[model samples]
Target: NIINARLRGKPGLFRVALNGERIAAIVPQTDVVAPAKGNDLDAGQNLVVAPFVEPHIHLDATLTAGEPKWNMSGTLFEGIERWSERKEITTHDDIKTRAKKTIGMLVDHGIQHVRTHVDVTDPKLTALKAMVEVRDEVRELIDLQIVAFPQEGIESYANGRALMTEAVAIGADVVGGIPHFENTRDQGVSSVKFLMDLAERTGCLVDVHCDETDDPQSRFLEVLAEEARVRGMGARVTASHTVAMGSYDNAY
Candidate 1:
């Protein structure tokens, strides 16, 4: 399945050729043969790059902004509490509908890849199951990567570890954690280590929601980075939402 297109970049027009899903050739328009009729898309001087990649998103919690209740406190904890209530009444069909609808919106925006975190804290693993279904259903339209995210504290939640393990065993593409939400800093560090070990054993990628709060003392990002370095995971590990890093003391 070869396809040809005239792509626009900073300098000038370029002829890009794709074989199946890979770029087989790229040459300046002047040096390339004119693509046959009906086989090319001349971008007409529009900047053409690879499709967008949404590295971090919450598909399970999306489209439920005001269900059950609103976040009166406007804090992450409040939002989590509200979501807990919302998921209590959410059915499988409801989750699938909202997820597919969101995927449609992403496809419309030229987003061809998405890595969505589906909460696996529930005993039933409802969100994880629904996301797995959606990931397969929308495979033709987008590269959907499902992360088994423990939105709650991994060690803090009694069954968090079990649920996350089940998610990986079933079909999750990545393992996720919320170290900043753990009850204590030590627990946070432990959770990061646990998640990294799970990823290593399962050969899955690691993407943790680390240091998302405004507290400058939230240093779980440091632990995550150090562990990734130690394990040689390199780019396969992604520590997202390091909001607290901006507030850290320069000397420290």
Candidate 2:
């Protein structure tokens, strides 16, 4: 038997055996092997689980609240607009410092995996570069995945595709979009298609900020699902912030 070690909860009621980094078996506490073998660790009856994962976070925009002012409107649009002003003064060092500190907090909370969306709409790619540096620097402590996100819009923003391409070339791990922020419904649908095509071309995963509004007519998620199904990229695609789903009718 190639058993690596055993993990137990306080008093050893539940036990799990590992092979290398993978779980080999989960046995009862009564069946646990003696710890004298030097591989058994009792976790003191607390909840013993795999490290936590944070799926969606904005590393570039985090810890920048109330820089020039506050988001009095309390809407996503207002937040984005306010962030634009703050972003004007942002530097690579600023992004790296904030991101590293936030990652430290996440690690303290037992989060070993995190996927962060870094804004790529900026022509300078300041945040993307800094995040890539942070990603490599913290690789030993966390699995950090970066998304090349066009927070403004895919088509609505100037040179958005070019910026996104530069972002991935510099080490962004995934493709991202903000379809709900497009100028119109037609533009929103087109943006999703563009992102799906981009993902296929680059062989990157997709995560979109879809319909993060309370409007019942926000249907970008439906388009996103259909595109994912048509392209056979089902599980690899994710639609985040679909708050509008709450307003959907039961029949829908």
Candidate 3:
């Protein structure tokens, strides 16, 4: 129970009740209430509300803005290049320590849920494995969803499809793809279809970097939408960083 909590759209201090981890009720404190005792806390008229959610983040690549070199151009490709160089020196403890420290900061700000994209392009699957362990280590603090993301082109990288399949097989909760980076349009469409089919087979959620590009001709998002519609997986689908839609000839 929390006494003297100031909730939004309400007048005066309110007594907030809790059942386990959830808020049970809230009653106005019209009269002077005694100081909280036992497990209860006194809010001291401070605003009290629900926890926050971090919808999308790259926890695998956190706290490494400039390791070997800086992204002076600040382009997505340049950032990816920096990450590739950093991946060479990535260790399991390194990933977990950085991820845990970052999560601690996020939890301090009231975030209780997070979805992170872990790059799975490495042949050894180092980051994906480390993130899986971190997910279990911090289960009590927050709900962590790890995405098996292919930062490099799925069809362009060596044994790319196989690496993605192995990542999901290990412990990835969501299947991810970056279709716009493929060498050709046909390859992009093929990559999207392969990932959707893999998600359907594995019963995992789908979150694709559908068109992370500015080319107006990039149309991989259409393939993703069609696959989701055909598979009846709309609710389980997420398209992230789809910048190409903004460059379409007639678009919103």
Candidate 4:
């Protein structure tokens, strides 16, 4: 009864050995045990290796489809607007159900860790509360980190900042901001500063959706980078969707 077996040495010319069972020895080429009389066991050259990490992803919006309507504009802003409409109808049960299903999908795909951003712009904090429950429920299968994401602008939407703080109070693992979505440039920059302060106060990681636009003038990423550097929270800060970086001019 061979418990485990692995090939060692050069490809197509390696020694196969079995261990952790009755037979636990490395045999020479000639001494190698052949398959049963008629059974065939092909020794393939290539080997499969396990993954190291799952990196980042959004679990809250994973499986949501056609709630109020579809995003016909195909732009990120339109997606946000569409999501806002859908979010208005979001309930604790709705979020919990989708989150559990999304987590199951991640586990099946071999993802062991995930950093999910749950929108907290709603006053009810439905998604944030549901994610906390899902995180604890699936702790054994997948490691989950929840971000208190202000999908709507922190200052553009009424009571947005308060909702973000409430999410952190309810056990969100990170603080997130959408600076580019702010109504004005100054407000956009200010939102970044405010989110950083919130993270510091709540002792959470900072992840922002900065400069996710195609416009070349979008520069909130620099603001975020500078804020992260000044606060000594560079390592704990992550700037997502910095698409504007592609169009940044070197002269400035």
Candidate 1 residues 1-252, lDDT tens each?
Answer: 122334543465666676776888876654434546887765554556679998888988889998988899999889999998998998898999999989899988889999999988889999989889899999899999999999877899888888889999989999999999989999999999999999999999999999999999999988999999999997899989999988899997
Q: Local distance difference test, per candidate?
A: 0.87, 0.86, 0.91, 0.79
Q: Candidate 2: TM-score?
A: 0.86
TM per candidate:
0.87, 0.86, 0.95, 0.81
- Candidate 4 per-residue lDDT, tens place, 1-252, comes to 211223444333333344542335534343334445543343443332343355556667767666689889888788888888888887888888888887777777777788888888887888888889999999988778998888887999899888888888899989999988899999999999999999988779988988989888989988999998989999999999899888888885
Tens-place lDDT digits, model 2, residues 95-196: 999999999999999999999999988989999999999999999999999999998888899998788878888988899988888888898988898889
Find the 10 residues in a row with the least total lDDT in model 2: 1-10
- By TM-score, the best candidate is 3
Q: Model 3 segments beyond 4 Å from truth?
A: 31-35
- Estimate the TM-score for candidate 3: 0.95
Give, for candidate 4, the lowest lDDT window spanning 10 residues. 1-10
Per-candidate alpha-carbon RMSD to the true structure:
3.0, 3.5, 1.6, 5.8
Q: Which sections of candidate 4 miss by over 4 Å?
A: 1-54
Q: State in Å the error of residue 176, model 2.
A: 0.9
By lDDT, highest first, what's the ranking?
3, 1, 2, 4
